[model samples]
Target chain A: MNRYGLKEKIELRINHATHHIEVDVRDTLLDALRDQLGLTGTKRGCDMGECGACTVLMDGKPINSCMLLAVDVMGRNIMTIEGLAQDELHPIQQAFVENGAVQCGFCTPGMILTAKAFLDHCSNPTDDDVRQAISGNLCRCTGYRKIVEAILDAASRLRRGKRHV
Target chain B: MKTFEYITPETIDEALELLGEGAQILAGGTDLLGEMKRGLATPKRLINLKGIQGLADIRSIPDGFLTIGSLATLSHLAEHPLVAQHYPLLIEALQRTASPQIRNIATVGGNLCQRPRCWYYRHSAFPCIRKHGEGCFAMGGQDRYHAIFGGHRCFIVHPSDLAPALMALDAEVRIAHADDSRIVPLTDFFVGPRDSLTQENILTRQEILTAIRIPVPPDNAYGTYLKVSERKATDFALASVAVSIAWLDTQVTHARVVLGGVAPVPWRVKQVEEMLIGDELSGKRIERACERAVDDATPLRHNRYKVALVKGLLRKALHAAHRSREKGEK
Candidate 1:
């Protein structure tokens, strides 16, 4: 059904790499990232904005890629979970691993990315702040106690200027 | 989602020229894209409004009104310092919206223009009246979350949290067309199913909402918004109330009580407002005033809880406003 529209060619910088792709106007950023660009780290849970599994950093702000049109993000910097780690895991990711915050690991990438953005603004957050910050990202496996601890631990590590991945 | 032609216009004039039949305006795309994916809306052309500049600014004129662009995202509005200090009701409502990620992408205009969350209307499988079907399934089907105040033929409840708060604050929306521009009260923006089942709002196909103008409240005005959702987070409200009351020493001088998730539009209860005026908001007076809010409610089969829920929410919201006024006095 999507084969009949006018395909538009747009260029976007995804994960610090530039790619030019032709996409239908109806194609969402989530579909373009996974199908066209082969960046499957961003999971599509509900395909709607109800789930945050498709959360990605659009121009340094976390947004749901599933709800955003790919053409709307043209010339903007797009960062997915694939861009979170360089040579090793980022601090928030390392904390998630150490704190055993991964149950099925489906919500890990989105959770860690959201944590990274939240921590960048607020390095000192209380338990309630952490809970409210990650309220958008749903985790069905863990009861979120450990996930909150992981984010708090990541904030502490970042405050100490610990560059260990 | 159905394939459609997309146009990103750079100016308001260009956008207005491009907007017409068979074209849908795309703001943050949080609501529009979801509706398209669910097959509820099928447009041949999609007009992306993000490219237009000056549509997302939140500016407050000195000692005058606060103008919030319609394209401003919920996250931005929730975090703005001026909004937090001046319009806490909007902040509270925006914070309790869909979720963090959705709020980051959902625009204020899009939130106010979102369609009803009725299961039958949303699902393409069922032919509902809103979609030009023969009958409304919720009229006789399961309508636990339907409206109790303004259910005529369709029983869908308005899904926006900000609309109620805006209406309570007496906000005005700025609409732009190709030939002219006009301002409309936020209260008159939404239309009922009885008025026109095909459209939920008064906005026509050729007009675009540009900004929201909120006049500065009186110095003694205190406002609060309370929502009772099924879940603590990321759920639509079962019943919600936004109350703004002006205090003269201790007596209530003016009040605006608006309810959400309980009607086709932002339900404003003038009887409750009139009852509260010229009287001190004591516990007994608040209880009595809240009871009057549901005097005209006509509940459906399963939504009788909403009548009681609205009363409780109204009472809680008034008490909150009273508390805020006390704090301000101190």
Candidate 2:
């Protein structure tokens, strides 16, 4: 209770591939992802849950990491934009650049992460599916048409891979 | 934000034991933490209910009750096949609340228990009746999206669309105390601002809302919920309705009509229910029922548009429900 404003012991594993950290329960997942763990890929745009700038996957589902408390995600497996690329760009990231989906690149990480989550669930998505997939992410410099193209193009590649195998 | 003590209890009893007058129980933190950061809601202690064991499950109980855990996210409710099949009104309401990202972290319990979205209430400078001060400034200030029914001390409409749909489905609450539990109807869950001007719910500070139970209606029931708002989505409803009609071969055997964004609570319509009883849902009957929706509405200066909007949406919703009754499972 006496150490660094911690009233209770909180054992957390954030961006777990990198490090194990201990934080207070009051700290949000966005804080742990940005400040403590230095996994700044998760942007902190709106501290409120209005924007999807802080989107992350907890146990394979997309959620607002800003609205989530660090202690709430204690034992849950977390995946961020950093976890998506392992010295190699993911298919969605590749498609984003190939289709000119990213502009200003501030909202790209969150949009790409949201797309990855959707593609993980659905391989063959229609235009409406692509629109619905990234409906939460807001691109101010606005590359929606390109984002939809990238997701549909990636869906084709993924489906072709499955058919070849 | 000022630093406060945090506790994550794994059981309802433990969470209740930690709650007190100024201690807030954290369901989803979608509302509480944002308020804390803005200096709008300053609770001394935050009791996190996430670590609790059974507060996240959604299952059907015996006696035709669909029990929804308090920790069940709005995203789950929006996509759950069972909820969509049984209560389409509820699904539509959940679909229209905020964005997909916000729904992922917002809890079903917290959605109903949320404070008003009034800019003044969040700003804390208006000295509104909600802040335990003088009268609301929205009365004389820019009051575009204020109240139209059953609002006196404060004129903020309820922000939750899911709350109205759930109320129309005859939902019940499971409030867990330290050593006991109690069940109350969803309509009776909220207290008016004129009643207390501070407290929004009837539950004590120590009671944790464990679960919600929605009674299962008959199999051949048709329901439609619609909200007419300003934006395409991600905005609160200017006016909303959840109408569930039990269709027996052709006629509406049973009807539950409830309105949202018209008052501080879900603002049920008893006159509409009485008007629709034992009558076939023709175009004229639907129009008659829609007219009765705003019979008791006392619209404020800027909110008079809501009455006509509410009438049109209810008429459209009734027609949609009637079409669904004839179409059978789209």
Candidate 3:
């Protein structure tokens, strides 16, 4: 057993793009996305899955990226914060901005991704539902009131089927 | 995290063959990865079972059993229409589990097989009795979350929210070895602290849990799962209760009361179940049963509050079951 570690080349389909990178067998998806692929938008807070800052979409469902190995996600559709915006800000991001949901901006990417997944499945969610949906992602700033408002606002805008910049 | 050889096995036989002394089965990697990162588990090889086919399906098998594959994630199980229709107790427990992100990846088998979240056992510095150390630190240390029942030498409480609900529903699990497999009741799968100090479940290092089999609930049966935790998401239960009862014309025909976060295993109160089998769930009857639920609980220093907490949960659960029976709710 080599002490330094063993590396394997694997292809990851992240954010609708395929990238083949050499990663250590022990490297988590969060590590690979940040270090190798330079997708630093996904933050890593409390890598033990307690904090959802490293959350990303795995097959249209939110999952903590830090708890999964880089090699584990092969041939699966993975979407991150970067995939939501094509030319302008996505509706969720716009709602977050308009509602002042972002204070430190550290948890923005993960919060947006989590809200996006929740709003995709539940179109008419109550305030309690949005609060429960984003319980995993923690923001020390904003006290979560604005985050809740942003998600509810985003849900209404999404129900209208309009993409606002 | 330490470097290890990771292999994705495409078959159950291949996965079992690869398991050995220094190997660990990786399912969902929600709990196992955390242990690896904390240096609590240092395996040389990781057998990733996600590549196996037919291990993540949720379908009805023969013999009126709805068999849930071991690899089925909690989110999928909670969102399954059949699960919601057949067993809402399971859905209630699953929704109150970790969080949406964790439920999306945490497997049902992995949830049942997860180690205790006891602070003493988790920290490497303590080396408590569960970790093969000399003595249990929680016995004399901070024991706010320790077990109030079934504590022999260790005081750690079982952390899984799904086990109690499954036990109440009389679920069975299939464990697979190299060439053979056996089905065991979900109640028998757990190992109490008195029986074994090192392991929580009866699964050997090589055996892998394959599927969970739940019989279709009987008609006129009402069940509910109630949990009390510090926070709504990403929190372990302080005290929880799962009650499944069947009544015909306001008389109890069957009852199963299982309590969690108060014992080393999901504490099944046959005493309370027997008390409710022949009588109706009236307010006085429920109060007596709730008091009987904690008669044998020997609380540690800081967890005496758990006795009252668990009793409160039992009262609420029984009341819910009572209301469901009255309204003819399935």
Which one wins on lDDT? 3
lDDT of 2 by residue, B1-330 (tens): 777767777777777777887788778888887888888887777787777787988988778888999999999878888887787778878878887777887899898889888877888567777887788888878777888887887888888888888888889899988878999999899887777678677888767788999988766777778988887567788999888888677777888898888888788898898788787889999888887888888877787899998898898888888887778753
Q: Which tens-of-lDDT digit does each residue in A1-165 have in candidate 3?
A: 111247888899998889999999899999999999999999989999988999999999899999998888878888989899989899899999999988999888989999999888899899999989888898868559988999999999888875443
Query: Is candidate 2 or 3 superior in lDDT?
Result: 3
Docking class of 2: acceptable
Structural similarity to truth (TM-score) of each candidate:
0.97, 0.94, 0.97
Fnat for each predicted structure, in order: 0.68, 0.45, 0.72
Give model 3's DockQ, 2 decimals. 0.55
> After TM-score superposition, what is the CA distance of residue B249 in candidate 2 from its true location, in Å?
3.8
Cα-based lDDT at residue B24, candidate 1? 89
Query: What is the per-residue lDDT of model 2 for residues A13-121, given as tens digits with 9 covering 90 to 100?
Result: 4445535677765788899889888889999887787778899987777888988877677678788898887677877888988999877888888888888888888
Residue pairs in clash, model 3:
none
Best model per DockQ: 3
Put down candidate 3 lDDT per residue, B195-265, tens digits, no spaces: 89999999998799999999988779999999999987889999999999998899999999999898999
lDDT of 1 by residue, A46-157 (tens): 8888768888988778888999888888888999999998798888989998998889988888888889889989989999999998888888885599999999999998
Clashes of each: 0, 0, 0
- Chain B only, TM-score of each candidate: 0.97, 0.96, 0.98
